[model samples]
Target chain A: MMSNLLLLSLAVLAAAILGCLYRLLKGPTVPDRIAALDTIGVLLLSMIAVLCMLFRTTAYLDIILVIGILTFIGTTALTRYIERGVIIEDGDAEDDR
Target chain B: MIGEMAIGAVVLLGACIGAISAFGLIRLPDIYLRSHAATKSATVGVLLILAAAFLYFLLYLDHVSVKLLLGIVFVFLTAPVAGHLTGRAAYRSGVSLWKGSVRDDLKQEDSSAQGPL
Candidate 1:
């Protein structure tokens, strides 16, 4: 019974991922694509959680943490890059030749 | 019996909410509103699903999964920040608001700051 429920949840989540992918592909603006990417990351995390339950193992636990950390870092870096042309500030303005 | 039923129900509801959030992401008029759906609805959906897993591990297995708990906390903390940063970046990059938007509070503030007349 629990396995059945897991399957059902997985199906719905798969559909959600597809929707997010559509937006990611079709999003007109950079932020729109970034938002879709963020949503996709969250959905992927949830999918991993469901998979852990289905497999009845704790091994995937660390993977979840890794994904979360990567998502946070990636989103922050992308946002900074979008807002400022350069991701890292150069102390010397003439550094870039 | 009841525990299994509750878990199933919670997971189902969470998935449904997640689907709706994705729908909103595609259907919304602007990036701001799409971010609204993606951040709030999707965050709550994933949280609910995690809650279901937490309940299952605690009740059926008679053990707590520390990782699931950590995931719940991590998601709750980061989702909003991701959304906010994306929206702020979009605004600063000159993504225009929807045509029907009534007020331009940020624009007003910028103009007021520059005004010496």
Candidate 2:
């Protein structure tokens, strides 16, 4: 029964991932795409958590942490790029101020 | 048996919420509204699923999954920040809001300030 529930949840998460993928592909603007990407990341995180339960192991927890850190950095960097048209500001250029 | 049932129900509920969030992501007309759906519902859905996992291990196996706990905390911390950054970027980059939106409070405030936003 537990496995059955896990499988069902996995199916639903997969469907959700597909839906986000559609948004990612069809998004009319760059920020729209970024938002879709962020959503997909979160969905994947939940999916992995469910998979861990199904497998009856804690080994996959590290994957979850890695995904979390990567998603945050990716989203933040993309956002900064969109706002400024550049991700990295030059430190030496600001020394005159 | 009862605990197992509870866990199943919780996981199912979380999955359903996640599906709903995805539906909103696709259906919403603008990036801002899409961010709303993606951030709030998805965050809560994942959190609930993580809670279910925590409960299951704690009750059935008599062990606390620190990783699941970490995941819950991580999601809670990051999701909103991502949404905010995306929305701010969109607005700053001049992505127009949906026509049906009632106000432009940010624009109005920026215009009145006579300074860079």
Candidate 3:
């Protein structure tokens, strides 16, 4: 029963990710794409958590942390780029508006 | 037996929330509204699934999983920050709001006064 539930949840998360992927591809704006990507990251995180439970092992626990950190950084950097047109900013640059 | 069922129910609920949030992401009128669905409810869904994982290990194996606890905190803290950044980027980059959006309080605040310092 436990494995069945975990597998079901995993499937649902996968389907959700596919939905987000559609938005990522079809979004009219850069930020729209970024938001869909962010949603996908969160869905992937939950999916991994479910996978861990289904297998009854702790090995994937660190992966959960790594994926979360990467997602946050990726989203933040992308948004920064969209806002400033650069991933890193140096003071006194004229392009910053 | 009951504990396992509890975990299953929690995981099921998280899955449902994830599906709903994703649906909102695709169906919403524009970027801002999509961010609303993507970040808030998606964050909750991830949190619940992580919590369920924590419950499963704690109840079944009597092992304490620090990483799951950390993940819960990490998602809870950062998802909103990411959403806010995305929204700001979208607005500043001039992604127009849905026509049906009645008002933009951010726009009501003078753009000149809010220019980057």
- State the lDDT of candidate 3 residue by residue for B1-117, as single tens digits: 878988988998999899999999989899989999988899988899999899889989788999999999999999989999999899888888999988788875647576642
- TM-score of A-chain in each prediction? 0.90, 0.91, 0.92
B9-115, model 2: which lDDT tens digit per residue? 89988988998999999999999999999999999999999899888778877878887788789999999999999999998888999999998878877677744
- Check candidate 3 and list the clashing pairs: none
In CAPRI terms, where does candidate 1 land? medium
> Which one wins by DockQ: 1 or 2?
2
- Give a tens-digit lDDT track for model 2, residues A1-97: 9789889999999999999999999999999999889988888988988888888877887898889888889999999888887777897665221
Better of 1 and 2 by lDDT: 2
For model 2, the DockQ equals 0.66
- How should the candidates be ordered by lDDT, best one leading? 3, 2, 1
TM-score of chain B of each: 0.92, 0.91, 0.92
Judged by lDDT against the true structure, how good is candidate 1?
0.87
- lDDT for each residue of candidate 1 in B1-117, tens digit (9 for 90 to 100): 767877877887898899899999999999999999999999999999888877877877677888888989999999999999999998888899989788888887755775421
Evaluated at residue B68, the lDDT of candidate 2 is 79
Spell out the clash pairs found in candidate 1: none
Query: Ten residues in a row with the worst lDDT in model 2 chain A?
Result: A88-97
> Candidate 3 at residue A22, lDDT?
94
Q: What is candidate 3's local distance difference test score?
A: 0.89
User: Which of the numbered candidates is closest to the native, going by highest DockQ?
Assistant: 3
Clashes of 1: 0
